[model samples]
Target chain A: MALNTQPNLFEPGKRYFRAFSPGDDFYEALIETHRDLSDEQSEMVNARLILLLANHIGDIAVLREAMSIARAGVVAKD
Target chain B: MLSTYQYPKFEYVRPPEIAEGRDGHYPVVIVGAGPVGLCTAIDLARQGRQVLLLDNDDTVSIGSRGVCYAKRTLEVLDRLGCGEEMVQKGVSWNVGRTFFREDEVFNFNLCPEPDHHRPGMINLQQYYLEDYLVQRARKLPNLEMRFRNNVIAVTPGEKQASLRVETPDGAYTLTTDWLVVADGARSPIRTMLGLDIEGKVFMDRFLIADVVMKADFPTERWFWFDPPFHPNQSVLLHRQADNVFRIDFQLGWQADPEQEKKPENVIPRIQAMIGDDREFELEWVSVYTFQCRRMNRFNHGRVLFVGDSAHQVSPFGARGANSGIQDADNLVWKLALVMDGKAPATLLDTYGDERGFAADENIMNSTRSTDFITPKSRTSRTFRNAVLGLAEHHPFARALVNSGRLSVPSFLVDSRLNTADDAVFAGNMVPGAPMDDAPIESVGGEPWLLQVLGDRFQLLHYVADAADLDAASVAALQSLAEGPIPVEPIVVAARGRAPAGLRTLIDAKGRIRERYDLQPGTTYLARPDQHVAARWRALDPARVRAAVARATCNA
Candidate 1:
């Protein structure tokens, strides 16, 4: 129910050219999700994809933690 | 272009002012002979005001524009004596089906309840609507229709509004006590006054093809989102009268409007949707980009703006013409009172207050429908697709699918003219809401409730028994009937013989009582346009007088 702030994503018996291959795979898939999209479209896809994933996650605590962490250093306009 | 229908050209005769080489003044001068202007002229003239209607053109609308007429608009037209003709000539429809890709997402019945006189909506060509209105206007002796007289300039003044009009003979100057500007969206009068409409112009285009074909499609509105034929756009299919079907294909901002309008490009699109074998002729084809905008104030001193001249909305909801008709309905009564000096000129301000509020509501709904149909950003489209995808099975998601909200009369709940309810009510017939129509039995025969409710301020008092019609109640009714701004009192009885002297309508089935949420002594004060001004559980003479005063802006 709560966010796993610690190391969470894992795959048994997996190796990569560098560490955090799971994170790299996620990054690569995210990039591929926005492959042919323009910047505006990619932003739209990111927003909707987040909503879809958030609905799937279905955890307020995890969403709050993820959102806070994502927004940690970004200054929002008034 | 339509084979089934031919446009009738009205003969323009030289006006008396031009023939006699003299200027003239009138009580009410309406610019533009469109549906709104014609309706306004008819409404004012029927109330014994002299009205001169000027139009640049001599015929009805060019094409099948504004095909859907809502129930509220039909009711307004009924008051102008044009409702029956329009309903008979138009295609009545209430059901709407929405499709997502190839699958049917949801269908809705606009008027699920029975016994209402008019349907949820009717699809009639704009030309027919204007023609019917013109015919009705002609029957009114006080209304003068000057077909070729075009208003070139308007000068609004303290006492009157002056207009420079051009006709076949020559240009002439005329003045009117009140000027009604119903000249449409591209109002030259609005431009001459240096006024501007403030709102959002959607970056989208739609091609309207009125295809004449003998097809057996049900009389229902069918809307498709991202269908296979269109492959990423929306399409709306509606049945108009005379074998004409209005097909609107949503073309995105990047689409070439001029290229898409060509018959060669349009024919294939229609064929792709309806199939190749069906024989059909393209009646009319036009591309349009819409905006949801309105003037800051509809009333500018002596000059009043009505219909498209005051506000405009996207065509998706059919709000543009319907709301304009309502605007005329709302303005005429107020203007009559102000002109007769029964109500202060300030009463006219509520026209702006109420209809301005309505304009915003319409603009908001229209803008939302436009956004859903044409998503500006990719994420919005993603959500739109998600909603459409989920809507096929899930009921909640169907609610999220917004093809078009469809035009409904705006409830002027916050209008200053509406007296706040002092008693508990259990129905939708609240103050500032349009009175719901119900079937009732009169002395002559059975007629709809609204048919008997005369075109004036009305006191609808409910009486369950003869004892309820007390001396105090009769006195109150008599006083209101004889007031400065007279209110006609109509008695609605649950079960009874006609009252001795009162005008009584028999609520045989108690539908009127149920719809109005009437107890034995329930009373309602309705405005001239049939909007509820106030209601009370029990009739109080002083309170009714105060409410009437407030409704007329005298308080």
Candidate 2:
């Protein structure tokens, strides 16, 4: 097996404050989905949303890479 | 069927006037008589150190505070002479199920194999554990338990600590060569000495309600994340002894503690979890917020901290009391050696190093579990929900569902006391890991490996034939066994082979060899707490002596 030494894709990028970005619009819409629902229903919406995104990203290798990237950055504050 | 909670009554004892006008200095003074404090006293007493145990309260803990006792904690308790009674009385559990909504997401079996003496976890009231420890402490002549005696002040010096004791009669002052602080989370001794515990205080609350009823729930741990009845919060259930069950409801940060603890409000929560058709009586109700923090240093001058005073973790992992018991276990022998002048004072520092590592491991796990249970942000909640939903159908995602990673014994990988392996070795039994227990047959009868290791430095010689060991190796073993604080040498012979001389233990059934991955002439030097100090493929006297020296901090 070849060693894939990509400069840890998990490293946190510099924060960019956005005022007119679509990311803000998506964040508001995400909160709107759980506006009046119970916590369980909100959690279900989240689960379904994750499934849809995961399905869109299809490849197993990509999913594993993404998970590792998500987990890598923060050193436990010991 | 319902039952009422009964509290034990203890007589208040008056202390002698050592502080009044006498020049008396005690060897060791332990403050607080909780399970950790009492166990520390018992362990130190077993090592022939006279211990003075003082408790402000007259009885054991008020409620069923810590009910889940891990197997490693039980092993330490067994070494202190209370194992059999605790194992007999406590409810043994090995299975845990985690549920998402009404569906079971994942289940784990902690210990499936059955040659071990203790179970993975036991559900007994904290009062019962304290009762066992106090009873065991009473029988030791070297240990003196003083009730209604509170330590109001503490001043730590280079060689000794000056302590002011408060009693009903009045106040008195005394000096001690060494002081132990096991005074729970809000340790006054820790505060008086000006020590700060640094870590995260999770903004989450939990309601603990112990109910008594004759229900048929299997002896297992059940946890639910966002259950049908308890809508957005989590809930936990465990069956204790005497028809009592412990139920904890995860109330968010904004919940009112006082109003939630009221019987009127608490009864409905219990009724919702366990149906109202099940008749039960509320034994105790408590509301607490989770905090994951610890002192920067456990060893402070002449005073040492153990249990909650040293470190505190969220209750999700049951690391709070179990790790406290382990702290006492790790400290007693080192403290005893330091007090006896057999080892240098630097040996006491390893207690802080090793247990600090453990505390960090516990804090990391507890913090992760708390965040998973009570996600602080929208993105975190989305991922947590994703993991939970995937966990139901895919085996890969099941490992992601964290309903409190259960407590396990910490492996001291970076301990300075351990001698690094320079030779080729097999098996997971490394130098710093606790020795795994296996069944062995001695001259008397079959005894567990842990039972034989006991509370002393041990040289475990795994030999196929006595003829294979060199004369110098044999002499080194003899010298170790004949030292002042002798290290017992047990020659574990291969299956059915009897090595006539020296203490021989038969590896009947070959379980010992398999677990330890023992070669023909492997040697392992273990600390008094049964933690492996050093091991080698072949014995070398110079290396063995150096390892022992380093382990005792004489180097």
Candidate 3:
């Protein structure tokens, strides 16, 4: 046990993580994934969604790589 | 031809070329033989069920994915025989550092290596952990590993789930009684199913650089506020093993990733912070953005999501992989029992409720961690700087840096899972409250459980024994301890005159008075899965039995 300290967001301790919560885009996905959009819109939305998430995790390059990975995926499959 | 899908972590290919049998039919087909998926296979195969695990790529990933292994995940892997391998291969990290300007300090160990078990976190690459798991999956008589096979679609129905795999020769369909989607965040299965994922996006971006430096940088972690040392941003550094350093520097949300890729971006950041500080060569540099979102439901009929596919959290505190693995540990056993008909399908619902709570809490935690570290608002910057300023002169002021708030806990669902009866335990774990930890009889290790078992599903500890237990009370313990499932006993006697095998618990002199609130001639009952269910004094056998009977009826 260590000395008690005031609670801090950056402080060392156990905390929880949730990617999607109420009113989050995950909730939006329930509405979005259910609706129709153009391939371009969906693609941009998808790209934004991926980038949005990638950025949140603290790495944009990997996310860009993830995009490249996804794009390469289309080519590889072809 | 099967539809080929791409995920953030790996590419999915179908009809994996590696394993194709003329009549290759698998009862259970697991896609992406990552740690969680493989562990799921091991759990199913353990019950004499043959399983086929498919990987889209030719081999296991040779990179880092989830480097942090939690205690629960270790226990689950231990059950699958890879526990030792993981423990041996990974470096255990317990201490964490928080930097407020030049004033640096190490907080308490994030996770500890107790005298008996492993420590807080294991900083091993994702691929290494998966390799050990894949090897263990191979040894199982009923397990098969298929590579280069991509699963195109996941269709789940009331009775079964099917996967369309595009193999080398041709596309084939695999039908399994159940499906566990351990695919990474960009989960095709999740997309195909159209499950709702919700969360906010932080505008910050950082680079994850894996480097091998010859010199020591304090096996301790370092957090930088006036980051990049010179460029002026936030930086976080972690040392996992000898010569291995994981550094993260916030990229201000709009920095050109390509520009940073120029070896030019590297020196400035390093020089500013370390000032040509020592020799270190970068092995891998990847840019990433994090999202905190979770599938509204972990299970949509037979298809279930674990790991990033189920949810995602910002990488603060190494919570992403650690929690994902815990999701696996929590889901597998309950799924196993349901699959084996040992329990009903409702048992699976516990998986979502328990882990979902963990997920929600994690999102909140990582979000706070992010907010505190970044100067998103002027007020936040001032508040952060004030704390940093205080921390420099007042060691106690550094409490802001030492707070352990990010250790998101998925404490079991309150009801019967908790067995301590302090009324306070209508919530989480507290010692001396009729809880139980199980030690597997045939298995090599101890599996602790805190429980007051039987039909009542009670948690009894601060109560009397059966012999001296008042008649009605004896009937209650029996009903709780023997009925629906066995409540394994873990005896904790009063300190001074405890029995030989029993551990010393509450002392007659009231050593545990602050916590357990001990008293003489009283017994307590905890629920199954270990949390206090009820406490009693002087067994009124009929009343006790009646209470036991009532709980069973409700459960």
TM-score for each of the candidates: 0.89, 0.87, 0.70
The two-chain DockQ for each candidate, comma-separated, is: 0.03, 0.04, 0.05
Chain B TM-score by candidate, in order shown: 0.98, 0.96, 0.77
DockQ of 1: 0.03
Regions of candidate 2 where Cα sits further than 4 Å from its true position = A1-78, B1-5, B18-23, B465-476, B496-501
**Which segments of model 3 are wrong by more than 4 Å?**
A1-78, B1-28, B47-49, B111-116, B228-231, B275-277, B394-397, B402-408, B413-484, B490-554
- Candidate 1 lDDT, A1-78, residue by residue in tens: 766544344467753221223543443344456656786888878789889999999988899986875554244642
lDDT of 1 by residue, B53-154 (tens): 999999999988889999999999888888999999999999999998898998888788788999999999998999889889889998899988889988
RMSD of 1: 10.4
- Interface-residue RMSD per candidate? 19.0, 14.5, 15.7
For lDDT, the strongest prediction is: 1
Order the candidates by DockQ, highest first: 3, 2, 1
Q: Residue pairs in steric clash, candidate 2? A: none
TM-score of chain A of 1: 0.70
CAPRI docking class of candidate 3: incorrect
* Better TM-score candidate (1, 2): 1
